[model samples]
Target: MLLVDHVTKIFDPGSISEKVALKNVDLFLNEGDFVTVIGGNGAGKSSLLNAIAGKFFINDGRILIDDIEITNMPEFKRAQWIGRVFQDPMMGTAGNMTIEENLSIAIRRGKNRTLNWGINRNEKSVFEKHLSELELGLEERMKTKVGLLSGGQRQALTLLMATIKKPRLLLLDEHTAALDPSTGKKVMEVTKKLIADGGLTVLMVTHNMKDALEFGNRTIMMQEGAIIADIPLEEKKTMKIENLIQLFEKKSHTPFANDRMLLN
Candidate 1:
């Protein structure tokens, strides 16, 4: 389970530029829950994700994973239990490294390093098995440098690396936002397969309303640092983009004004 208890974050507190990014937000996710978050700019969607991931300290409240307190843990320390995929394809992987080398590091996350050669036949076979699931023929490019892969391929590989060890929580920060439409759909398919296969708990932030409704078990809408609406799978299945916009306006008591979100 994952918990965000009364969490709040403020930037430049008590100054003219002060901004409240999160406002005593409380969210709980059960095991294997896949929730998609949607919001306009400055709605604190990414702030919530960064807070849970320990990218920065929350000004108040606590964060816990499976009953263990991690509120004060450094980002690197928290990484053991958290797997993240960023929006930019280049941010998640080591471009200069070979695909196998990158996977090797991910598989060894939170483990002590040894002087032994990084890849053994057994590990290679495991890598091939995982890469084959992407069905992008990445297994054949194991020895190739990751920098040469296309944006979608690299994002797919990053997704694989993030869940290879079955992290307790996965944070996907608009991970498919950078891909072309077709490529993005392909990546989403792979994402669904992996989540089901691993029974992974995921929190995905997305701007695409169609994706928000289509992909996850539940959808949450944020506005000005608070979750104003949460629709479960049954409700979401029947909701269209127009209905979602109406619902957002009704819950937020304001017009939906984010042009980028509407355009997507």
Candidate 2:
């Protein structure tokens, strides 16, 4: 459903501090494919997602979503085609908006605004059903302001908002990183259920090696802005933490070098 072709992004081009964030990176995700991305610092994981989301234009190369070229599209325009959940829980929703209000916005994605009624009975029932699956009691508190929620609760709500429209592609940028381990695991569980239930395509960036292995149909390891290894689910299931480290070292020839990642 998504394709990136030989994309490259260089920051501060021709300047002394020029840093190559992405170097001819290419990847493709078929419909319903859930791919987990892993890499150390400076691996261009975020840059790659940003490039596809059209946060900014790449210096060269093309980004296509279902055969529609969007390499140069603006971020707001791309919002209709892609859904993103960020590492920071605070980013994906309006803190002051009530739960129902926030969901009302997501439900209207990719559509022109109308003078229609908002948050009526039908929509409320749909939101309630979706929230009930999170098992977080959010369905009972639909009138509460989102800012009143805990990080995990807010993130759970954001996950729902992002997928309400069954976006063509889902981008998760270390979305569960800020939560405690148990909470993060729960969030990942919810993520898996949603993906399967909708047959959605997803690309999730994560620092935890185990999550990278356990959660997706494919695992991709990046280094210096390019994919060094792409392991299919069958091969990935047989991979231990040690095996992954070895493969990363062999491919990047420098060992996956994040202290936090190793300690985790």
Candidate 3:
């Protein structure tokens, strides 16, 4: 459902400080495919996601979502087919809005707004049903302001909001990295459940090696702005952590330098 062909992204081109964030990067994802991305610092993992999300125009090549070229599509325009959650818990939702109000906005994503009642009982019921699935008791607090909730709670709500209407693709940019272990695990569980329930296509960037291997159907390793290894589910199932380290070292010709990834 997604294709990135020979894409390149350079910051400060033609200058001494030019940094190639993405170097002719090529990637593809099928419908319902959940891929986890792992990389050391400056490996273009987030850049890859950003390129797909249309955060900035690529220097060259093409990007397509479900066969439609979106390389030059504005980020807001691409929201019709894309849903993303950033690393910061505070990035996805309006903190001052009530939980239900926030959900109302998500429900209306990519749709024309009109003069009407804010949220009907049926919509509230649906939101409650979805919130209940998180098992975080948010269903009972729909009227509460999002800013008052804990970080993990807010992130979980953001995940729900992002997926309320199934977009063609979901981009998870280390959505769990800022949370504590147990809370992160909870959010991951919710993520898996929602993705599976909707058969969603997903690309998630994560620094935690164990989470990378455990969550997605495919795992990709990046280095120096390009993909170095792509491990399919069957291979990843048999792949040991030690073997993965060895593979990265062999492929990149350098030891993996992300201590947070290794320690996780």
Put down candidate 2 lDDT per residue, 8-113, tens digits, no spaces: 9999999999999999988999998999999998899999999999887899889999999999889989999899999999999999999999999999877776
**Candidate 3 global TM-score:** 0.98
lDDT of 3 by residue, 64-159 (tens): 998999989999999999999999999999999999999999999877777453799999999999999999999999999999999999999999
Candidate 1 — which residues are off by over 4 angstroms? 262-264
TM-score of each: 0.97, 0.97, 0.98
- Model number with the top TM-score: 3
Instruction: Pull out the clashing pairs in model 3.
Output: none
- In order, candidate lDDTs are 0.93, 0.91, 0.92
Error of 1 at 24 (Å): 0.8
> Which model scores highest in lDDT?
1
Indicate the residue-level lDDT of 32 in model 1. 89
Candidate achieving higher lDDT, 1 or 2: 1
lDDT of candidate 3 at residue 188, scale 0 to 100:
96
Candidate 1: C-alpha RMSD to true structure equals 1.1
**Residue 236, model 1, lDDT:** 88
